[model samples]
Target: MAAVDQNSLRKLVEGQLLRLEGNAFQDCMDRLGLVLYPGDYQPVRAAGPKGDTKNDGYCPKARVFFAAHATRGETFAKTKGKIRGDLEGCLQEHRDVKVWRFLTNDTLPGEVDQFIDNTLRPLYPDVTIEVWGLKTLADEISKLKQGQVERIIDVITVDEPEFEVVVLNHMKTGRDLWPVLSNCLGWLPHEEPHDCTDDEQDLIDSAVQSFRDWSDISGDIEFSRFSVRDAQRSITAILEELAEKRLGLYAATTDDYPLTGGPSPFLGTVAIFRIVRVASE
Candidate 1:
């Protein structure tokens, strides 16, 4: 076997680190439901306080700060020092801001971790710092992929707010598995019910049954795998049927409202469904 060239190894590591940082940044933003404005620069830059002056008036309302490094030892130290200096400057400029740091690298030295906890954290209490080595990013990516599965479910249930609501409610009711399911669903586990009543339970049950029936029908009519669009259509069809029967489950008024209007509850249900499917899978 031939030994790998040092230049080639460096290039490969750099490329991988760049890609991973981009992905990690995107994942963090998506998890927080943030609409990321385009950034012109890479997450990590070369070490120095020279360009630090440019950030004098650059107060960003970013909840998180991410830095990626491709090398270890002294190189890591120099890069971290520059980033810390820059961020500290930013924090000093903006008094009431909090920033979380995510550091991505193949390995982290013990002394560096200690420095982060003991030195940097104490100095900047407003900045919450988290370090992710290669293994951590790998694990996070796996979890994100699982979340994507439920996101597909959300897309399918878009048209069926009633069904989505019932599914979310059922997820809340199931004691043992509910927490795990709720994480997948992107909903915080609530100890108290969110205004679900006995009558609402009956409506929810019917809606869930309608979804299952539609899933069965979809399996027979088209492909084996159930698509979210099909799920949405099925939910919509069921809601329309219930409305025709004067069930009074949905609002009677057809007037357009804001995104946070009467129909917004149903929209939230769909959002929760997507979150659950992504997290669970």
Candidate 2:
């Protein structure tokens, strides 16, 4: 089988892996060197021994069994619990397969690593269990391919507001996006306003034009509405780009500068955005 594309790999993790038929997952696991147990069937719902639940695959050469945990209901802890039960069933049939490899399509809470150490590891002291969460796939894929990883990180946050949430899985280990992003904002200056050189002004002008290109300029335009809307979209596009690349952007209204000569009340303000990451976990 051909190597899986980035989009398929992304779909497997961030997308609907459960929707995938057994063969699709089998192919993906195969890329990672795991051979399916019931070689003739798909993995999504392949059956194991009569009493045991379905086992995705097993690499007989390495004494390892593969299981797919497609649960998005909660964190990896919940997923891990379910896998433990599956393992118990499988162990009844094949006690010789000591390694259990779980592939998950969910974001794991930071404490999950220690949980594995304290819980799963202690329970199966002789057996080795491995978890492949969002971060793990990204790490493995990056190592397999050379530089220029197609999928950097998966952002999984629907909770916690006070914290600027970031998972280092998508983090560009050798580079930073802040300076690159700052260069994209024309209105923002890298140095003091008065100290900008002619070349710097050219760069700023080029960025302004690039932002203008993002706007849908059709028909007669209200300059105020156009400028502000374009600015808003400019901010949005840059933010989305950064986020897609595993970078975080945070913005809050700061200052408002009132425009003159217009009979309208159009307040202009300078907003700033920054790249973010989790400093603690």
Best by TM-score: 2
Kindly report which residue pairs in candidate 2 clash with one another.
22-42, 22-43, 22-44, 152-170, 153-170
* Cα error, candidate 2, residue 6 (Å): 12
Summarize candidate 1's per-residue lDDT along 196-249 as a digit string, tens digits: 467645665675444334433332344423454445555566555444433322
Off by over 4 Å in 1: 1-62, 72-76, 93-95, 146-281
- On a 0 to 1 TM-score scale, where does candidate 1 land against the true structure? 0.32
Over the stretch 1-281, how does candidate 2's per-residue lDDT look in tens digits?
11333432333233323333435544555445422233432333444446324466666555777776555556566755777777776676675867887776555666766777787779778889888875565446545442222212211222211323323223231123222222221122222234445764464445434433432221123346655455455555654544453444333322332211123222232223333432433
lDDT (Cα atoms) of all candidates against the true structure: 0.38, 0.45
Instruction: In model 1, state the lDDT of residue 80.
Output: 65
Candidate 1 lDDT (Cα, 0 to 1): 0.38
